[model samples]
Target chain A: MRVLGVDPGLTRCGVGVVEGVPGRPCTLVAYYVVHTDPEDELPLRLLHLDRSLTDLVAEHRPDAVAVERVFSQHNVRTVMGTAQASGIAVLAGARAGLPVQTYTPSEVKAAVTGSGQADKAQMTMMVTRLLRLPEPPRPADAADALALAICHVWRGGTRSKLAAAAERARGGRTR
Target chain B: MRVLGVDPGLTRCGVGVVEGVPGRPCTLVAYYVVHTDPEDELPLRLLHLDRSLTDLVAEHRPDAVAVERVFSQHNVRTVMGTAQASGIAVLAGARAGLPVQTYTPSEVKAAVTGSGQADKAQMTMMVTRLLRLPEPPRPADAADALALAICHVWRGGTRSKLAAAAERARGGRTR
Candidate 1:
């Protein structure tokens, strides 16, 4: 399965694409970050985000999209921007007619590093190893996007398999 | 000028359309609320919000769009939802190439009630009076939206006139 993962932000949004299915390793297709100027008007900035993401979706043509779910207890300064950026990501996916999946930070960390509380260094290392990268991706955001891509593949794969099995069972029996 | 004001929320989004210029009395064209099931998935709920808001914009063809700006130092449980909803509202406006304006709670209250700290009852009364409604709009969300519409008409009208004056001055300058 091909998946495009978005690490949403107002200033720096990370985009990563991964290709693979269950029982096999995934390869990173491309990873990059799109930046929007803080000085720009809010609507213009969001429009830039939407346009850039639409371009990215067109270029990658991934089968599905994964977005990092945003939650914060602190981050008073960043929370609103992050949440708004995330909404833009979801809207981009919806516009592209892709099934957008969201994974929490803990879920992504656990899926990649086998620990929900994995530190940034650990996450970087694990994501690098998973994709067999030459070096850890720069600026953590790209790595997080890769982790989101990885987590969604595994989790969504399981869900799809279960759904198929249930369909089969239902087909074999009376409704 | 016509303005469509959106009071954004995940569970209940309020929409109101008003028509008139700043000096003249603004009349309410329509007001309503769209509710999403709390049990619905986030993506689906957002799609509902987007679709409904898009239809509203299409129906009203407002000259501009207004959205309630979200802020939270407390109210943790609802902050993210509100921010996301507000983001969707702005996105809808941006998609339609409409100028999207935002107002804080205090700004709206001050614009409508001439008091930054007006209470909810006061807000309702002011919106009812401003709209020249037969009775106060049902539910606080709808009233809040009407208040937003009125605020934008008064505020945005001044901004547009200023912009026109600036353009005229620029046009007169030597190239």
Candidate 2:
């Protein structure tokens, strides 16, 4: 499965595409940090993000999308921007007819680094090794996006399999 | 000027269209409550809102749009949904190439009822009177959408005049 991971934000949205199966190691197909001017109007900033994300979806054509879920923070303004960016990400996926999944920060960390509370460096190191990259992706957001995609490729695939198995078992019992 | 006002939400998004100048009392052209199934997936729910908002904008062809700004709340989950919905509203306006403005609940209430802290009944009563409606609009969200449109028609026009005057003054001094 090819999955796109989005760490949604107004100023800088991180996107990473990964290709792999559930139990196999995933490779990074592409990654980008889409930047928008903070001085721009809110709608314009959001528009830029929207267009960039839409273009990325068109280019990669991922099977599923994974986005970082917005959580409450001390700064309500910051959280609002994050939430807005996240909404755009989800909308982009929906527009492309792709199933989009949300993963919390901890969930992505746990899936990538085997610990929910792993530090940025640790998570980066794990992603690099897992993807067999020569160097670690920088600025944390890029690496985090890769982690999200990797997490979803594994987690979502497993969940689908389990759901299918459960359905089959129920049908067998009824018959 | 024709204006579209949106009260963003997950289950029910209120939309109202009005037409008038700053000093003149605005008339409500149309209003509707866009509803989505609570059991639907998040993406589908958002897609429904996106399409409905898009259709409304295309049908009315508003000169501007007013969306309720998402504010901080004690319930993080609820606030996230509101923020997401607000983003969708803003995006819809942007996609339609209309100038989008956001008004806080207090700002809308104050503009319509002379008090920022006006209760729902007071705001509804003022909206009904302002729009010359036969009775209070059902489902408070619809009334609030009208209130937002009224606030923008009055306040946005005043702000535009002030901005234009400032520009004139600046040009005179600079030249």
Candidate 3:
């Protein structure tokens, strides 16, 4: 299955697309970051994001999408902007009829790095190793997006295998 | 000056464009809600947002953009999604080289309704009244975005005027 992962941000949003089935390792198809100017008005900034994201979607044509859930702190202003960015990602996925899934930061980290508390650098290294990329994905956000996709693959695969096993057992009993 | 307001969301991102200068009532130039499907993959969703927003910006070239600043809460998942949406708005504005400004929800309500505690209905009523619209802007999100733009006009105008006056005073004395 093809999966696209996203790390949404106001100034810079990361996107990664990978293709693979449930049981096999995935191949990195594409990855990039969408950036906007800090000084521009919010509407225009959102416009830029809308266009860039649309382009990425049309190009990659992934079957599913995964995004990192936001984790907010004391900065209300920052959190709000981040939320807007995330909304765009979700909306885009919905419009295209793709199954969108969200994962928390810790869950994504643990799935990729085998540790929930892994830092940015660690996650980047792990993503690189797992994908067998020649070089680490530039911009931490892109790497994070890739990791989220990997996590989805791992979890999705496990679930499907279990389901298949149950089906086989039921068939044997009937025979 | 023209101001564009955005109420960023994952499913329906409301956008309102208005034209006005300091001390002048703003005119609604255009307004619409951009939507994306929730089922699509994250990257495709973002791509849709980017394309739609870019079209909106191109159709209506506003001088300034105003957006609501996100406030923090206990819900980590909600906060994260909101932040992502906000980030897209910021980036879109920056890419277009428009001056982007952010306002807190309370600040916007206070400016429009003369009370920070005003609820959505009250705020919508006030926004319609202030803009001289026949009815409140359709969809709560659009009204909220329009209110944000009005707030910026009311507040940002005064600040700019004062700065200009100060600059003139200094220039006169020096000359």
Candidate 4:
């Protein structure tokens, strides 16, 4: 399955596309950052982000979209911007008729680096090794986006398998 | 000027349209609530909201859009949802090339009721009286939305006047 992951932010939104099956190495389809000027008005900034994300989704055409869930932080203003950006990202996926999922930062870190508390360097290293890239992805946001996509692909696969197995078990009991 | 006011929420978004100039009783053109099932997935709920707000803007063709500025609250989850909803509302206005302005709850209260700390009942009462409506607008959200629109109209007018006065003073001094 191919998945698009978004690490949503107003100033810099990271987007990464990955193609792979569960329990296998993933291939990097593409990755980029969408930037908006902080000096611009809030509405204009949001509009630019919405359009950029819409175009990105159309170009990649991933099977599913995954976004990093925004959490409240001590910096209220920054968190608000992040939440707004993530909202636009989720709308982009839904508008394209694709299933969208959100994972916490820890979830992505655990999925990619085998530890929920892994540091940025560790996540970047793991992502580089897993994707067999010669160099690590620049900007921690990009690495986080890749981690989110990888997490969704693996978790989505496992969830479906578990559901199927449960159904089979129930059928056998009924029979 | 005609203004569209949005009090953004995920479950029930309040929208109100008003037409009038500053220093005059505003006329309420329309007011309604957009509802979304809370049980529905986040993306679907947001998509429904986006479409509803978009359609409302297109139909009303307001000169400006006013939205309540979301603030951080004790309930982090609710605040996040509010921020997200407000983001979509702002996008609706920006996409339509209308000037969008956000006013804090206190600002709206001060503009309508002459007190920043006015309670919900006071706000509703003042809005009804200001618009010359026979009854109070239902569902506190609707009243708050109307207050936002009223606030924008008056504030926008006053702000421009202040700018022009400052410009004239500067021109005189420079000459």
Candidate 1, clashing residue pairs? A1-A20
TM-score of chain A of each: 0.90, 0.90, 0.85, 0.89
Compared with the true structure, what per-residue lDDT tens digits does model 4 show for residues B1-175? 8999999998899999999898888999999899888877799899999999999999999988999988787477688888899999999999998878888888898999999999999999999999999999998789889898889888864664565598788883321
Question: Every model's DockQ, to 2 decimals?
Answer: 0.60, 0.70, 0.32, 0.68
lDDT of candidate 1 over A1-175, digit per residue (tens): 8888999998999988998887577898999898988876677678788888889998999878889888867488988888888988887887787778888888888888899999999999988998999999998889988888888787865664576598688884321
Writing each residue's lDDT as its tens digit, candidate 1 over B1-175 gives 8999999998999999999888667898999898988976676678889899989999899988989988866478988888888888998888898878889989999989999999999999998888888999988999999888888899866785687589788884221
Off by over 4 Å in 2: A160-175, B160-175
How many collisions per candidate? 1, 0, 58, 0
Query: lDDT of candidate 1?
Result: 0.85
C-alpha lDDT (0 to 100) for residue A11 of candidate 1: 93
lDDT for position A69 in model 3 = 75
Off by over 4 Å in 1: A160-175, B160-175
TM-score of each: 0.91, 0.92, 0.62, 0.91
Candidate 2 clashes between residue pairs 3 or more apart in a chain or in different chains: none
* lDDT by residue for model 2 (A4-65), tens: 99998888899999999987899989999998888776777787898999999999999888
Q: What is the lDDT of residue B31 in candidate 1?
A: 93
| Angstrom error at residue B112, model 3 | 3.4
Q: How far is candidate 1 from the true structure (C-alpha RMSD, Å)?
A: 3.7
Candidate 3 per-residue lDDT over residues B1-175, each given as its tens digit: 7778888765778888877776667887778888877775454556666667767777788776777776576356555545565666666666676667778888988888889999999998987887899988888889988887788788865664576598688883321
**Candidate 3 regions with alpha-carbon error over 4 angstroms:** A74-77, A157-175, B1-67, B73-102, B113-175
What is candidate 2's lDDT per residue for B111-162, written digit by digit as tens?
A: 9999999999999999899899998898989999989999989997567567
**What i-RMS does each candidate reach, in Å?**
1.2, 0.9, 5.4, 0.8
Best by DockQ: 2
